[model samples]
Target: MDVAGIARIATEMTDFSTKEAVGIAVLKKAIDINAAGALALIEVIPDNSQSAPNLPLNLGRNINTIA
Candidate 1:
């Protein structure tokens, strides 16, 4: 997939903030390096069909926000 597709999938799969989203978009596309930063942290939440490991308490705060 292209950068846009990757960004979209990342967006849908995680609950990243606006700044984080832009940073991820920029990184994935390499169209803009200005937005890259540590704020782009990601949290993955697996669906019923998928198996996911339990994240540490500090990392699982944004789990299962998707509909």
Candidate 2:
């Protein structure tokens, strides 16, 4: 192939590589943001386990299904 054709192909390949890199970087950022948000949400959930300590320990241990 001529020099011009080779140059064009190289330029196209470079552009494709750059676009792919940018896409991957953006996806990583989005995933990081989502993970941070999920952790924040999880942290805010009230700890109900300690709040009901007054109930009997065996209250929920067994189920009576003979009724």
Candidate 3:
């Protein structure tokens, strides 16, 4: 309609676009941080399977059902 109203709408649209871009950037950063943390956790896990290879294969297969 009027030039002032058009200007206000354009400004509001620009503000919304900027906010949306910042939100997306923040989300990507958060995802990257979480992935790094997960990788760190995976790296810290002890590799116990290799430590006791000589044990019998059936050792852990049996469950003691008698309470």
Candidate 4:
């Protein structure tokens, strides 16, 4: 079989898609953020970086270290 055919088989079995795997990979990477020191990001999310409003930061301090 040709190289393309082999790739198709591989994608269909284990990858996201046999056709749109590239797009899926891109999206997964874009949204696959770490749960450490990162807040939940939403689309069209308000950019609080421009103002010092009275918004309460929900972040916690990891004080279990022996520093």
Question: Against the correct fold, how does model 4 do in TM-score?
Answer: 0.24
What local distance difference test score does each model get?
A: 0.62, 0.91, 0.91, 0.61
Clashes of 1: 0
For 1-67, candidate 1 gives per-residue lDDT tens digits of 8999999989876765777888887777774443443234333434434454464444545678688
Q: What TM-score fits each model? A: 0.22, 0.73, 0.75, 0.24
Q: Tell me the TM-score of model 1.
A: 0.22
Model 2 regions lying over 4 Å from their true place: 51-67
Clashes (N, CA, C under 3 Å) per candidate: 0, 0, 0, 0
How well is each residue in 1-67 modelled by candidate 2, as lDDT tens digits?
9999999999999999999999999999999999999999999986656757888766666899999
Regions of candidate 4 where Cα sits further than 4 Å from its true position: 1-19, 34-37, 40-67
Report the backbone clash tally of model 4: 0
Residue pairs whose backbone atoms clash in candidate 4: none
Model 1: worst 10 consecutive residues (lDDT sum): 34-43
Cα RMSD (Å) per model? 21.8, 3.7, 3.2, 10.5
- Candidates 1 and 2 compared by TM-score, better number: 2
lDDT of 3 by residue, 1-67 (tens): 9999999999999999999999999999999999999999999986656657888656676899999
